[model samples]
Target: MGPIRPTIADVARAAGVSRTTVSHALNGIGKVDPRTRERVVQAAAELGYRPSLRAQRLRSGQSRTIGLVSSMPVAVAGGPSKLGFFMEVAAAAAETAMLSGFALVVVPPLDTDPPLDALDIDGAIVIEPDQDDPTTKRLQSRGVPIVTIGPQQGMDLPHVDLRAPRVGRLLLEHLREQGARRIALLMGSGHRSWYVDLAEVYARFAREHDMPPLVVEADESGGEETGREACAELLEKHPDVDAICAAVDAFALGAVRAVAERGLRIPDDVRVATRYDGVRARTSTPTLTAVDLNLAQAAASAVELLLANLKGTEVPQVISNPDPRLVVRESTRRG
Candidate 1:
């Protein structure tokens, strides 16, 4: 046979203390004198007393951990801008997990094939997963519960859809509220679907309210220069445009620069807003007004959904629709 496992009673006896004191010292609960706690720890160490994580998990019926995967495309400041948003998601998920007696393990995309067999997570949350991604398909096949952040194209995956069109509507409503009539839309390339939906929503809102459609397409050349050129061209093309709703924050910043170059003041000549609430928006010269999607809350909810599935809790095909809150700031409040 193997060596017998030491127990808390063994530790207490070795430390010449009651079991309650030993328990208190080990769990950091209630009160135990400092020296006594230290002595208990020393005794436990001497006795090779190891707390049984497995036993604890069995008793609690929880793995006490979550796995997080970010399938975000690796592009230099691309449409997703994974760093800030994904980090917020992970951090908030970790905090919520810890509160509910769990931990978070962030797994970046594997260079080789993803090995589901090697992963021992209770559940997972996939951020910005592509619909046709094989890794995601494999994970789902393994009965590992998952929640996706952005919209998935074809797969029947549970997700919290970030309504891109609503983002446009929010900005339109804000601009309208601020008495903006002529609005211009700044769109990025490759994400044609998102911008198209946004344009559709903007047009519907404008037509319903009897306003002119100001849609301008910007080529995403993966550089600030292209964004600057696009902004300048659009501004020159429509000097009387009172507001701009950009698809992303960086492009919005570029628009701000273009507006300033024309010797026109922000909000006075051109108000601007974007869908993302990020550092670029916050640090812009006139602090852009954006729709705060509350990514943290969304992440937490996704994780909870994953955990529910992991627990065999009849995971409902839930669709989380987080409303976008318009963060009113200097950029768009006056126009």
Candidate 2:
């Protein structure tokens, strides 16, 4: 060999510290005195020493990698304005992971059990896991730490979630307050916890109020087109629905289109509201009344909870219950 690369031991020697101290200072792990850590860092910089990731992992038995899996395919989640919330949440999670010295790998939805052996990850974050999700089951069977972005039905994994039932109630109550006696709900056709919770709460609210409960389900993967079609069908069939609560912004935007096509005026003819606030909600014909789910905060909390679990800390079953903010706009305004 022409030249031997400087190692942690060499840096420790130059800094007059132990090899463990040097390791902690370089990796920002463990507790090292501030002055001593500074000296070790400076020595390592001067020596041009780079620690081997493989060696460190061997010592700690951790891959320092995280997997982010979605029940929906990445392509489907990344498609259009309707699925934009997933992208925003993923971006925030990725940033938080990087700050905590971990790499986040976005894995596409698996048709069958995931091959856990192929992934070198210490933990995983599952988004919108359906009941008995195969990927989640495989990861759990492998004894990997997992945190979900939303509650996973039939799984007791820690999660960071918006209060879906509360959001549904809030939207329905707001519509009722806006003088909508005959209201309809447009929701996704999925068994995901959020969808189930929203549907349950909506039905309960409609029953308590003694208003005829009307619901239309649509394929969320089809984006705005699906919402438009669902809303059109609901209006053509119900004809008397005075208000509509879309479980997502995509559906709300589509409902706006359907209303326009029927030559109806928003708020005056039929009010509309959405569960998740986004760009589409803001720029729609009559800016949508929506519940801001605070996705960024939820995303950050999910990563933090996953990191806590990876660090051998006891994570609570529910790390966060994101409060929904109701934003009233032209869509629900009354003259």
Candidate 3:
């Protein structure tokens, strides 16, 4: 090496400040006087000091890395159509993390116990955690800062989630407005909180309207095939069913195929809607009437909340209730 690189200590000495003050000013971690911070920054720039990521992590006790964990197991499947919504959320989170100077790692769900110790993450963003999930439990036990995409069962962690119940109600009301007297719900077998909310709302709305509650369960993890099979079964059993509300776009796409195979006209013979809107919904034949979850905003909020928690700021128990936008399409438009 021709010349040794300048270090934080050298900058600190040049600025006549302690090493800790230099760190705070450079990282914007702790509170430092404005003049002192400016002096430290100017000295570091003049000295050409570039702090090492590893050394800063060691000093701050933070890995400067966050993890994106999902209970859905969508990443391993390589099925982009089935995981469009989640993939978008992950993409947004990754972009936000990068801008905030944090590296984002996607962690697969553990079949066995979660190896929390093996992950060198400062915190995690869990997507749609279920009740009593081992991963969530392990992270909680370790005192890890966690932000969930949806409300976690029995945990009061900060969460950024779409209003599932409201979305369900909106879909139901729209179907009824379109002259659908017999509406059926297609849902996943998993008991995630969002699923529960959707199911409960659908049932309650049906009861309130004096309509028969028809609910069908499908292998949510099985993607489009399961959705198609579930829709076929629903139609075969209830030929009078005029509307179908699927919890995901994959399921809605399946329903569209099922309807076409049955020689039924969309929005006339049958109407279809999905709770989660994604690329599949927008590109499907007749397109899909679905709810836009505003995944980008939710991802950004989750990253911001996690960053705040990491900075030792007191974050209130956040249950973000963002308004869901209903996108109308040919599938649900009558007249």
Please write out the lDDT profile of model 1 over residues 1-335, one tens digit for every residue.
Answer: 98999998999999999988988898898989999999999999999998788866776666777787765332313434445556778888898888877788887644455555687677778776544556567777777677787656566777776777777888888887887788877776653335557878988998898777776666554444555668889878877888888886667878888888999888987888887787768877899999888888788788777777666687666656578788988998663
- Candidate 1: lDDT of 107? 71
- Candidate 1 yields a Cα-based lDDT of 0.75
Off-target runs (Cα >4 Å) in candidate 1 are 1-46, 49-65, 71-83, 107-120, 130-135, 141-143, 163-165, 191-197, 209-226, 319-322
User: Candidate 3's residue-wise lDDT over 1-335, tens digit each?
Assistant: 66799988899999999999998998898899999999999999999899997876888899989988877645222355445655677899999999999999877543444566788899999888877667777877787889998888678878886777888888999999999999999997777788899989988999998999999988866778888999999999999999999986778888899988999999899999987777787888998999888889999899999999899898775757579988989899987
Question: What does candidate 2's lDDT look like per residue over 145-182, in tens digits?
Answer: 89998899887889987788888888889999999999
Candidate 3, position 175, lDDT:
92
Winner on lDDT (1 vs 2): 2
Q: Which candidate, 1 or 2, would have the higher TM-score against the true structure?
A: 2
Which whole-number lDDT from 0 to 100 does residue 77 have in model 2? 54
Query: Considering only N, C-alpha and C atoms within 3 Å, which residue pairs clash in candidate 3?
Result: none
**CA deviation > 4 Å runs, candidate 3:** 1-51, 75-78, 81-83, 108-117
Best-to-worst order by TM-score is 3, 2, 1
> What lDDT does candidate 3 reach at residue 134?
71
